[model samples]
Target: MSAEPTAETLSRPPTTSGEAVAVHGVTRRFGDVVALDDVSLDVGPGEIVGLLGPNGAGKSTLLSLVSGQRRPDTGTVRLFGGDPRDARSRTRLGVTPQETGLPPTLRVGEVADFVGGHFPDPVPTPELLEQFGLTDLARKQTGALSGGQKRRLAIALSLVGRPRVVLLDEPTTGLDVSARQALWDAIRQYHAGGGTVLLTSHYLEEVQALARRVVVIDRGAVRADDSLDAVLRRVALRRVVLTAPADLSTWAGVVRSRPVDGAPPERQELFTPDADVLVRDLVVSDVEFRDLEIRGASLEEAFAEMVAPESTPESTPESSPSIEGAVR
Candidate 1:
C-alpha cells in the first residue's frame, strides 16, 4: 500500500453526518460463549461515551466488532456511513487496543512520521510530538522508552490520521498519575476539536474523568445508558455512619449494615436509599446515637453496586517482554 493518501482519500471528509458508531440488536458469539447479546447503542457526532463493564462482560468484544477486528455473528456494525469492514469507512476511524507493539529500533519521530504519512491530512510530526509531550524523546528508540512513554505514543498514533472517531479499549491501563493525567488532557483536546470517542475503562475514575455519558454492560447486556449524573443516580443507596445503641441492620431504610470492627463500641454503618429519613427515625425514636454521619455514594461506590455480586477483573498495565523489531 502507498504511504501517501490519494486524492480520493483526501476528498473524503470526516464523519460529519449521522451516528459515528451504530450497533443495533448485535449479537457476537465465540463458539458457545455469547460475547454480545442484543446490544444496541448509537453514538452521535462529537460525543464521548464511556463503556463500563466487568471482565467477561463483553467490553473488548464490542470494541472488536466496532473496529472491524472481528465480525459479529448477527446484526450489523456501521462506521461513519459505511460498513466497518470497508477501508473507505475505516479512513475516518482510529483505534488503540488494550495492547500495542512498538518497533524497538525505530526512533519515536520516525515512527510518528511513518504512521502520519498514511493519511491525507496527518498531523505534523513535530506538532504531534509536542502536543503529546514526546518532543524530548523524539530521538529515543522505542526499546529505550519507558512504559508510560510507550502508552502516550500509542494513543498519539491514534490521532495521527485526524480521525473523526476513535475507539479506545482501556486506554490508560498502566501509567503513573502524571502520565495518566497527560493522556487525559490529550483526549480532552481531541474531543474538544469535535472528535467522537468511545472508550472502555476498568477504572471507574477513568470513565468519570472522560465520559459525559456512561454505559454499563453486564452479561453481554446494557444495564444503563445515560448522562454521568443520571447513571450514578441509579445507585439510590446512601451511607449512614454513626455510633448507635444497638444493631441498625434491621432499620426500615437500611439495605445493609455492619459494625466498624476494631473501633469504638456500637460504631456501625448503615446503607439506605433515604439517609435523611433513616436519621430522622433515629432522632424521633431517641436512639442513643452519637457521631452520626451521612453522605451520598461516590462513583466508585455506585459502580460497585451496579455490578454487584460479581468479580470484576481489572485491566492493569500489561507486563510484557520487550518486543525487538523495526516497523512504522
Candidate 2:
C-alpha cells in the first residue's frame, strides 16, 4: 500500500481554474449503506456554498469525496479541473473536519507553524492567529484549550496555508454566539480575498449569514440546490403566531400547528400557505386573539418542508395536508 499523503504533498502550487469544485454522478457507500447516491454539483470560484442536512444525511460523505479523503463508488470528483485524489489537485484546498486532532504537547503557535510550513506561501502565524481571536492563546498547549478555543484554532489552522478553497464541516459547533460571529467575519474576509468555501452546518442562521447559495441533502440524495432566496421562496408555508383562547390546529388552511413551548398555554404557532386568507378568516369568525404575528417562513421552516415526506407534487399548497410542526 502507498503511504498516506502528507500535508506537504497536498500543498503544491494552486490551480487557476474558474471552477473550484466539481462532482458528477457520484455514489458512495459503506457496505450496504449508501452514503451518497448519484449526486452532482459544481461550485464556482469565490462562492460561499452552504450544505445543510440532518445528521447522517450524507453531508460529510459528500465532503469526503471532494476533499479526497474517500473515493466515490462511481463517477468523478474534481478540484480545480483535476482528480480530487491527486495531491496536486488538493494543493489549493484546505479542510477542517468535524473533529480535528492536534498534538497534545504542541503550543498553539507551534501547531500553526507546523501546518504553515507545508505550503509555499502561508499566512504569517501571528496574523492568522489574530484573525481567529487566538493570539492570546498562542502559548497554550493544544490539550489545555477549551472546546470553543480549540474549534477556533482548528479553523485558523486551515487558513494557515492560504488555500484557495476551504471545506468546513460544522465549523462553529462549539462556539458561543460572539465567537461564531467572529468566525463568520473571518470567513467573509477570506472570501473577500477570492477564497471559495463549501461548508456544512446544523445552524440555519449561520448559513443565512454566510451563504449566497444553499444545497440541501437528505437520504443520501440532493433534495434542493439553488440560491438562498430561491430555496426559501420554494417554501409556500407562512408562519402565523398568536395567543388565542381555543386551539386553532383545526383552523381552515392551517397545515400544521403546535403550542409555543414555555409560553402561556394560549400561545400557539400555526403554519399556512396563505397568511392573508388565514388572518381574514380568523377575523370573520370573530375569534379573539392577541399578540398576532405573521412572517415569511424561516430557513428552518423551509428546510422542514422540503425534507418532509409529503412535500411532493400531490400535496400542493391548496391541499389541506398536515405535517409534523416545522423544526423550531
By lDDT, who's the top model here? 2
lDDT of 1 by residue, 1-110 (tens): 11122332344334554788999899988888778889999987777899987667798899888888888888889887678887777877888733358888999999
- Report lDDT per candidate: 0.77, 0.79
Displacement of the residue 138 alpha carbon in candidate 2, Å? 1.4
Compared with the true structure, what per-residue lDDT tens digits does model 2 show for residues 1-328? 0121232124432346557898999999899988998999998776789997767779989998998989899989989998888888877888873445888899999999988887889989999998888899999998898888888888887788889899999888767898887788778777766778899876666777888898988767889899878765565479899999988988998876767766887998888889999999999999999999998766455555566565332222322234232322
Query: Which parts of model 1 are misplaced by more than 4 Å?
Result: 1-17, 97-100, 235-304, 307-328
lDDT, residue 144, model 2: 95
